[model samples]
Target: MRISKEEIMDAAKKLEPRLIAFRRDLHENPELSLEETETAAKVAAFLRSIGLSPKLEVGGHGVIADVVGSTPGPTIALRADMDALPIMEETGLPFASNRPGIMHACGHDAHTAIVLGAASILVERKERLAGTVRLLFQGAEEINAGAKAMIRDGALDGVDEIYGLHNLPTLAVGMAATRKGPLMGSVDRIELTLEGRGAHGAIPDQGADPIVAAAAVISGLQTIVSREVSPFSPVVVTIGSIHAGQANNVIPHRAEMTGTVRAFDPAVRRQLPDRLRRIAVRIAEAHRCEAELRYIEQVPVLVSEDGCLAHAQRTIDWLLGAERHAEAAPTLAGEDFSVYLESVPGCFFWLGSGPSDRAEDAYGLHHPKFDIQEEALAVGSAALASIALLRGQSNHSLLL
Candidate 1:
């Protein structure tokens, strides 16, 4: 007894008001990574309201609920991140963040709401369900630590397949997108410290100027993607922060830089840290300074399993019209959902939340002005519910 598109939509429509309220509440009371205590409690309460018991604090404020069907079958997981960014709210919506210096600018509020909506829809159809549906509300996605912690706490125990979605503000509302492989890039953190000698501002060759070395290293890093990496492979090396001298006259003995590296291919991702370190060290040495580099591989590339993606695509096409979905090009942006895909064969797709005709209303993710179109809540919930229903009907294994 598979649920139909009409049935899913009807349930989603009925839950729209509640979904919007949930999203707004979450948006108003934003919480940073690993400290989602209040948010977790709200989610648990919602799950309980749907007649499901959620395991709270699976991994430091993470929540998980299992909706077992009438009969035994394969288990499918639907995940949503429950964390906010550090940016302050500027959207000025009535339900804007009440917490200063924290905002749901990344659409995690909508993601969490949509998943809860799906849980309600799924719960209504539980009697006809063939398998179990695991609802995962993850924390710390912005810092890329939540997924790993949840997995360590047994979130993926006995899960056969998983699915998740992110809200894309650039795409028009009512549209969704995903690709067959490498939908998102791997993320790696980079830190470089250049050591030199300090001296008076007017010193004549009395001090080793690390600031000069740091500038040269930053410039040299730009060439890694242009020269070293394959032209076809996508890679990004950006130095987001740098700290050097304080005084106007004195040369600083140390300069520190921090940045990020992203790549879609595993080979390219693996080689980036070494290449970046080599570039920085050699450039620093050329300036008569020593360099220390620290590279931490944060998350792996998010590649959707073909079989699972096919299931998702079919569901999306049926629910939103075939033309409503597009094949998304691989992006350099990293998602912690990549961590979950590593353990279970799954597909991570994007839900469109941009304003329909008002281009000015659409703001990129992480921006203070960022806000999702409320209409996307219904679309996302329906899509997630349909995918779970479609996949639960089969005992098929993913072609990993």
Candidate 2:
């Protein structure tokens, strides 16, 4: 049976205040990946308070807690990110980040609180469950290594399935959505440097111009998506940074450019490095210079497992009913959740946190002023608990 909406609400109310405080506490002392010392300690203490013993620092800075069910069943894992971004806080709220140059602009604070709330309900209602529930407080999601680290540390050990959530600013609070296919793209960081002979600006023929070749390479890179890739498929090549010359009067010997490459399929993502490198090198050599291209694979393409996604949808329908559940378009943004899904069947979804305004381009996620309504916290908690309860009755591996 699906968990009742009333039960979800009841649990949310019971855990809301506690979670709010916990979120605020985390906000006041934000930490980056592999550096969340206090966050790890608090997560351990919170798990202990919930009557579950959580193993700490499993994957450098990962935390794991497992609650066995009353009956023999599978093990389901729920995860929350514990790291903050390197952004300065500007929300101006009293509980705003105390760390001057770091903030939780991605709503990980809400993710943590919601999971903890689910833990509280799970502890109190363990008899209703038929299997085990594992909680993963992962670090370095922003840096795209948390899930892999946690897996190495055995976070997914014996886990049959897993679930993750992200906060969406445009979708409105109390709502949730996701698809069974590619929910997010593969993220790769690319840096290119062009080298040429430097000379005085007045004598343009005296030296090869690296900046000129770099500019041409940047413009030509767009054709990769527009002409090279399949017409149906989408790809984005954004060169966000360019640095080189000290002044306009002199032609610099070197030009450095950095950008991100995003694609939905592994085949396409893998081929990007070769494609990008060739384009950069050829473009630079044509200008009597050379190009240095380096591709840093950050996050892999986030492919949601069909079985796990179906189960997640069922749990949502059971808890929120048909009216409250909806389909959503996938995004080009990437997530580290791909690592978790690799070891266990699972899906990562979004929870709408309402918008700042009705405008189509209103302040959204990752914005300094972006803030999610706190009530969504309750909704997220309920959804997480439902996943745990539903998994208890499915395939014995549902909990794994």
Candidate 3:
């Protein structure tokens, strides 16, 4: 027996008010990455109330629960990140974060509520499901470590395929979007340090200024994208922070800089470390200084498997009219859900939560004033539940 689309949509609509309250509760008590104790407790309590036993503290505060069907089939996993950003709340909503300097600026509160909503709907139809549904309430997504932590804790031990969604504040509420391949970029960090002789600012040639070398290296790094990389390939190398001398009269012996690099193509991602290092070292050496560069690759590009993407599209169309589905444009933003895709074929997509149809008119994610339309809560829930049910009822072999 397969759960019908009408059932999922009807359930989501009826539970919209509770979903909003749950999301507001999470928003009021936001926790930072790896510090989600109370949030985890709430998740566990909710799961228990719904007649499911959730494994607490999996992956450093992650919550996991499995909904088993009467018949045997493939297992599908749904993920929702459960962490907040460091920004202070500015939305002034009655349910705003109580923790100072911590806010759910990334719609993670809504994501958690939406997944929990799906869990409730799935539990009601568990007897009709053809396979099992694993719910992953992940932590530390802001630090890009939650997915790995969940995996280490065996979140994906028996999972056949996975699906997850992130609420896009810019996208209009009630609309959903996704792409076939390379939907989002990979995340990599760059740290550079330059060392040179220090002397008085008045000296003619007494000091080898690391500040000068650092400037040259930063300029040289830009050419890696303009001159080396192809125009068609999307890559971003942003030097977000730099530190050097303190006084006007003294030349600093050491200068440090930090940056982030992003790319959608794996080959381009692989080439970044060497290229960035080469530019920094050669440029620093040219200015009579030595440079040390450290490039750390964090997450891979989020590539959606064709089969899984098609499944999501069908779900979105079935639940909300086919016109509601959109082919999302690729972005340089990185998501740790890519980590799950590396191990098992899956699709991570965008669910619209914007206030209006003009996505550009709304505040983007991570802003202090960032927020999602409450209506998106039910839309996200129905989409997630429908995705699982549709896949579960199908022939797993043919689908995946």
C-alpha lDDT values of all predictions: 0.90, 0.84, 0.90
* Residue 236 lDDT (model 1): 91
lDDT of 1 by residue, 1-400 (tens): 4456787888899999999999999999999998999999999999999899899999899999998878677799999999999998998899999999999999999999999998998898788766899999999999999999999999999999999999998888899998987889999899899999988889939989999999999899999989998989999999999999899999999999999999989988878878888899999999889999999989999999998999898788888899999888778999999899889999999899998786346789999999888999998999998788667665322111
Candidate 1 collision pairs = none
TM-scores of the candidates are 0.97, 0.94, 0.96
Candidate 1 lDDT at 332 equals: 90
lDDT string for model 3 (274-319, tens) is: 8898889988889889999999889999998988888887777777
User: Of the candidates numbered 2 and 3, which has the greater TM-score value?
Assistant: 3
The candidate, 2 or 3, that scores higher on lDDT is 3
Order of all candidates by TM-score, from best down to worst?
Answer: 1, 3, 2
Per candidate, the number of residue pairs that clash is: 0, 9, 0
Q: Flag regions of model 3 displaced more than 4 Å.
A: 395-400
Error of 1 at 1 (Å): 3.6
Q: Write the per-residue lDDT of candidate 2 for residues 262-287, one digit (tens) a residue.
A: 99888888778888888899989999
Candidate 3 overall lDDT versus native: 0.90
